[model samples]
Target: MVNRWASGSLAQRGQANRLSHGAAIMPVLLIVGGGLFGSQAAAYARSRGIEARVFDASLEGAASPAAAGLFKEAWAGKRLAEHYRRAIPVLDRLYGIRGVTLKNDDGEDESFQCVPPSAILEKKPVLAKVTAVGDGWLETESQRHEGWVYIAAGIWCQQFLPELAISGKAGAAFAFPGEQPGTIHAIAPGRQAIAFVRDPGFTHFSDGTAERDYAQEHEQATLSRAAALGLTDTPVMRFWGYRPYTPGGPVFRRIGERTWLATGGRKMGTIVGASFACRLVENELRA
Candidate 1:
């Protein structure tokens, strides 16, 4: 059965307001970056009859594509309890979550997988870098866009808001030759190595390494964990990216009359992104 979220009816309804008089002139949402945060904002905007366009240069070390798309409530902990609750419903409405069993050496574990960002985004991002931004407007190399501006630039967001102390935690996830059974093996007492089918046709593995000064040793250690899982074949692909971190926690706030900034997804990009997207569209934008 086709899930309502994945159906074309929602897209058609999203465009319904465009045909209305006066509403047709509503400001378009100009989003910077095409990673999880930015894409989620765009998707939510579309659902609410707000037009949105995403500008992304597809810079190296983007975290969204590398994400395993797996998340659980425990990962959010107590501090992010509200975000976890808000995000799950939005994620479920946009992209149905599937429960999967993860086999571990000690026992079995449970996790949930949301569809990747590429699957939820309504359109491909315009391959451009936003050169400048202000209240309700932003400029690229040759064109200027005027609308509601949302900056979800991940770690590179520091360039836009120089005063905010933002940093990147880097890591790599490797994909082996063939499909493998889902498993989570302990890499350390608190850390675990994950082997799952994050993408079709490959087995994805990551050792949950998050380091500010990521080096060759970190990469080797991740590979070692994959080897311990008996995945010794030459990795078919390697995904390297940085998860943005803020001193306090995830950030979502209005920066200008019509501009909002969100980042600091860290290891919880999917949930944080969806939660912020809801706040941006439902509360901030519409209200």
Candidate 2:
């Protein structure tokens, strides 16, 4: 199956209206990033009647591709999980399941797999296994782990949206020290385990023409924090990606009149981004 959307008919139906209303006729909705969220948003929008475009720099700082790609359930919370459950059918239809092997936090080896309808009748059934974390489990006995697949965000986003945004940031990932289990790591809301400060004069990637070196500063700060967290020896892998920075709260805003800002998922960008896109189309773009 080509991993493309199936809503061309819907687009055809809306063609006349799109041509009629220029303001609402976003001949193309412009997306500013090419990470997982950006790519998925473009896909979901195109599947609807809306034309979507993505602009990406494919910079070293882009975070999605470098992410561990773990879709831990805890991140979804209650409301987001409901939204996710509602969106699952669409996601399953657009991108089906795959097989994977996962090691849970309890050091138990398990099978994780995405079972599309085609495998429903198979003899070997996929089963879920409980791990140390109350909500943690690995998809065992299918093919492989259920979650965590590479989306090729850079290529997929551009191939689907074919637009670009020129901004970047630095992000990093590190394996927990061997002493720790491979379960989901949870950080309490508003809890500051490590100390750091955003430069008093930090600039949003879209703000101004700015050139500042924060890489060393970031690395040193991260290392110091990791040391405090007792993971000093863990290897740190870095990535560059931009997330909307909002101290008040995360939001999806319309800048000026045409440009829309759908950024800032923090760590859950991929999960929430797709859901947000679906809602954006149904509520904002659908005619």
Q: Considering every candidate listed, which one attains the maximal lDDT?
A: 1
Error of 2 at 261 (Å): 1.5
Cα-based lDDT for every prediction: 0.83, 0.40
- Which residue runs does candidate 1 get wrong by more than 4 Å? 1-24, 121-123
lDDT of 1 by residue, 54-126 (tens): 9998899888877877788877889788999999988888887867668878676666565654565536899
lDDT of 1: 0.83
The digit string of per-residue lDDT tens for model 2 on 1-287 reads 11222343234434433445454334455454556565666677767756554544444555554343334355457745855564556455556545434443355654433332222111221122211110101122332211111122331222322332323334443333244322222134521221111112210011111122446665565555555544556453333444433333334553222234455455455555656666666665563
lDDT of 1 at 196: 83
lDDT of 1 at 222: 89
Query: TM-score, each model?
Result: 0.89, 0.48
Over 4 Å off, model 2: 1-26, 97-101, 109-170, 174-245, 255-258
Count steric clashes of candidate 2: 22
